[model samples]
Target: MKEFMTNNDYHDIGFNGPNYTWCNNKEGLARIWERLDRIWLNSKSIMDLSNAVVKHLPRISSDHCPILLQIENKKMHNNREIRFKNMWCSYEVAKGIIAKS
Candidate 1:
């Protein structure tokens, strides 16, 4: 997370929702939970979104939680969309791709 934040120039958006975003749904010593969900934004994007909000939705059937993000001031956002894919990072050559691009 540290490397990704520094390299991608992203800052946490600090969401509002359940404290734990994920869990094994078990009890006793077999149980586990974590705040695995989060939303991040570019520092420059804040200037464009005066009312940006992120919500961590309640856990459902999936093991991972859901996220909802709203940008209230779209007029100034300039249509820039940042996308990240975990699969793209699996390859060893991905570092070069990320660096070169």
Candidate 2:
């Protein structure tokens, strides 16, 4: 996590979720529970985005649910459509071939 964050230059870091989301369905002596997932950020992100937070939501299925992220930033324009594209899969020589294909 640290390496990824540092390489990407992310800032704030935190974990938000149920303390124990996983549990074994068994009697007293045989039961086991654990918190398996979490969210993370870095120091620069926290300092730059003061209102960022990760909130734990209600459990729905299995033993765990999802978390809600609240990031306070400038609002987007009403007509804007957000499009995400992954740029890390390109091979230099094959870039044109991949793009055309």
Candidate 3:
């Protein structure tokens, strides 16, 4: 999983609320808690969605707490607007091609 994430440029977006996401309904020492759920973002998403937030909602019925991703800023930038066509891809080579053109 670490290798895959590294290869794919995936990063975990830390959450707010309860630290432990999973819990075994038990008393005292028998109880078990762990964080098994998470929200991951790719390099592009991390860069484009800078205002995104991950929230860990309260657990009601299930053992795992629900996660929510809220995008505070939908627009990429307020000062300037950049547009891309459907045929254009945002790759390294594509950047060079667009720059050259």
Candidate 4:
């Protein structure tokens, strides 16, 4: 796994909340906990999503905890269309610019 990650320039982003993501539903010494899940990203992804965070959610009905990846300070809605006014054709400069295009 380490070799694969190194070759692909991927890194463990780490996590918040619980330290362990997996656990045995046993009592006392019979119980065990381990970090079996992880979140990884490549160098470009790390830079592109600098605000990204990993969080370990509660273990509900399953032995493994759910992980959440959150990205802050991002614009979620960017589907606005660029509209050009037909009135621009009335101006000499706009006509010159439009002709150049």
Candidate 5:
């Protein structure tokens, strides 16, 4: 898995709200939990989806838990608006610039 991830330039998208995804469904000492489900992304995907995240859902009628991915879909700011601080208005230069712009 390490070699595969390295070779493919893939990285794990870690989860929140759960430590493991799979369970043996046994009682006490016999029970076992493991992170069997995973989500991987390449460098390009990671860069494109900058705010991507994973979430783990509650398991029901199954030993393996479900997984979810949440991503922020913000468009690239090519023409972002300029914001001026309130304190900058105190300066003459800032007042001139603000007036000019």
Candidate 6:
């Protein structure tokens, strides 16, 4: 899997979700089921790759449920308040306010 990911230029968020999905069903010999579904993404396609995460959802009739991805990135409007205030005021008031402040 690592080799395949590397070949495809994909970055792995690492193994997440259920470990095993299939189990042998037999009498006297009991078997437990596990998770098998996983998620992956391209390294170049993601920003702040370290902030990306995966979570497993509840399993239904299928052996594996869907995986959820949470990605974080730098806020585009980090200084939106300042920009909004500037836009709200005219040049004369802005100059006066700046001078007073």
TM-score of each: 0.62, 0.46, 0.69, 0.69, 0.74, 0.45
Please provide, for model 4 over 1-101, each residue's C-alpha lDDT reduced to its tens digit, 9 standing for 90 to 100: 89999999999998899999999989999999999999999999999999899999999999999999998877799697967789999998899888775
Candidate 2 residue lDDT tens string, 9-84:
7654554666665666567989877665555566666677777777667667666656667887876668967453
**Model 6 lDDT tens row, 1-101:** 77987889776465455655444444564766655555667766665476777766556665456677877775567554543466536677577777675
C-alpha RMSD for every candidate: 20.2, 16.9, 11.7, 6.5, 5.2, 7.3
Question: What's the distance in Å from true for residue 100, model 2?
Answer: 58
Who wins the TM-score comparison? 5
lDDT string, candidate 5, 1-101, tens digits: 89989999999977797899999999999999999999999999998988998988999999988898898797777787777789988998889888887
* Predictions in order: lDDT: 0.80, 0.65, 0.88, 0.92, 0.90, 0.62
Off by over 4 Å in 4: 74-101
lDDT of 5 at 80: 75
Q: lDDT for model 3, on a 0 to 1 scale? A: 0.88
Q: Return the number of clashes found in candidate 4.
A: 0
Most accurate candidate by lDDT: 4
The stretch of ten residues in a row with the least summed lDDT in candidate 2 is 82-91
Lowest summed-lDDT stretch of 10 residues in model 6?
20-29
Worst 10 residues of 1 by lDDT: 73-82
1-101: candidate 1 lDDT, tens digit per residue = 69979898888878788777798988899989898888777878866674888888877898778988877654555567768788888889887888786
Instruction: Tell how far residue 27 is off in model 2, in angstroms.
Output: 4.8
Writing each residue's lDDT as its tens digit, candidate 3 over 1-101 gives: 99999998899988899998999988999999999999999989988898889999999999999989998866455676668775676566687778775
